[model samples]
Target: MHIEKNTFSLIEIPKIIDEKGRGNLSVIEKDGVPFDIKRVYYLYDVPSDAYRGGHAHKEQLELLIALSGSFEVVLDNGFEKKKVMLNKPNIGLLIPTGVWRELENFSSGSVCLVLASDVFNENDYIRNYSDFKLFVGA
Candidate 1:
């Protein structure tokens, strides 16, 4: 999965609003998501100044959505960096392989939902910043 620096993007999912409330759903079909879903996880009860995810994947794709509250995701592709805010339940940020990401500035009661393309594998992770930079040829 040779991803370029511009591979990451934000996708807006459809939200159904009605008289009672609002609802949204996400699918991992071929046309819906870039890859098939293999894992799902969520993060909640994070302190206001807490942070998470400071690594890059060797071959995995992820979609991050803020189910409630808000948070910020900082992405680095060795050559360039980008920061994105996740505050909408119906929107998600697509992070491809080879990009280092860090979740920070989480608002209280924030719930972050993550859809992954692969199952858990410790060997697939590049946790060190220097190593990640070398892997991405920075």
Candidate 2:
């Protein structure tokens, strides 16, 4: 790995729970992430055996949150790999630029919310693993 695997980690979103009859609420405001938020999207109805995210961004930063159900995210920083299980609605996996990622093992009705640092741009993506290694100069 040209980049350090430890660069990625989970972030807790602040929330408020009602002591009365209401449920809990989470908030991600303007200073919530490391970069400015430019886009937001979610994945749902994914087959349990299916996978997503087989690319790395050269300049985009992302945060993956499990809004419902659960899934596993594998992060690779050219030289090392780390597996993280995201099950909680209030926790997110923060991914920096130049790191490869793969998402799989999704539970039933799983929802994946992704917050990105920029709009969709095809030029920023490194889609193939072999090319990714070469991009990172590994």
Candidate 3:
């Protein structure tokens, strides 16, 4: 893979409002995107001293949003890096494949929701920092 260094584009998650206060909310994912949702997970009651998601996917794309409270997403694409603070529910960061990311500095009572395009596969994940650097050619 090529060493990529740039700010990845952000995608807006489609929100379905609750009607009549009898149903739940939903987020829809459309086709034609680089990735598709295959698994869903969330974090709740994260501590301020704990850091989450310190890895990169080789082929899977991830979307992260701060449902409650606040947090920071630090993205690194080999030569360049950027940090985005998310506090809104409607806005989210679109993390493309082959980029290293770290979700950290979460406020108490923070709920971080992650939508993945692929299921959990250890081979698809670059777990080691040196491996991530080597994969990005940094």
Candidate 4:
């Protein structure tokens, strides 16, 4: 596999809500065609000083959004690294394949919502650090 470093992508999602609304709705449409949502998951009540997401996927694409409070996502793309702070529900970060990530620094009442392109598969995860390095051709 050919893995490139520093491959994280930040995307702005188009909103469907208007100015008169007090509440919001989640809608995804491309070229006037709406895409069906497959899976929806959220993470809340995360303990302080606790870390999550220390792995990379072989073929999974994920979109991470902070629904409340704030948090930092540390991304490692083999040869480079970056930290992204997520504190708004309207903004989302698109995490691509072959990039290792660690979610940390959760503020009080922080909630993280994740949308994945594929279903869960344990075999697709590279959990070990040395193994992940080797897998990325490090």
By TM-score, the best candidate is: 2
The per-model lDDT (C-alpha) reads 0.88, 0.90, 0.78, 0.78
Kindly list the per-residue Cα lDDT of model 1 for residues 1-138, writing each as its tens digit.
343543698888766676565554544446666678899999999988889999999888899999999999999999988999999988889999899999999998999999998999999999999999999998
Estimate the overall C-alpha local distance difference test score of candidate 4.
Answer: 0.78
Error of 4 at 90 (Å): 1.5
| Candidate 1 off by > 4 Å | 1-6, 19-30
Compute the lDDT of residue 10 as modeled in candidate 3.
Answer: 63
Per-residue accuracy of model 2 over 1-138 as CA lDDT, tens digit each: 132333797789997988995999999987777778999999999999999999999988899999999999998888889999999999999998879999999999999999998999999999999999988777
Residue-level error in angstroms, candidate 4, position 82? 0.4
RMSD of 1: 2.4
How do the residues 1-88 of candidate 4 rate in per-residue lDDT, one tens digit apiece? 1223337666565565767877766554442121233567988999869888999988776778888999999998788889999987
Q: How accurate is candidate 1 locally (lDDT)?
A: 0.88
Per candidate, the number of residue pairs that clash is 0, 2, 0, 0
Better of 1 and 4 by TM-score: 1
Residue 81: error of model 4 in Å? Answer: 1.0
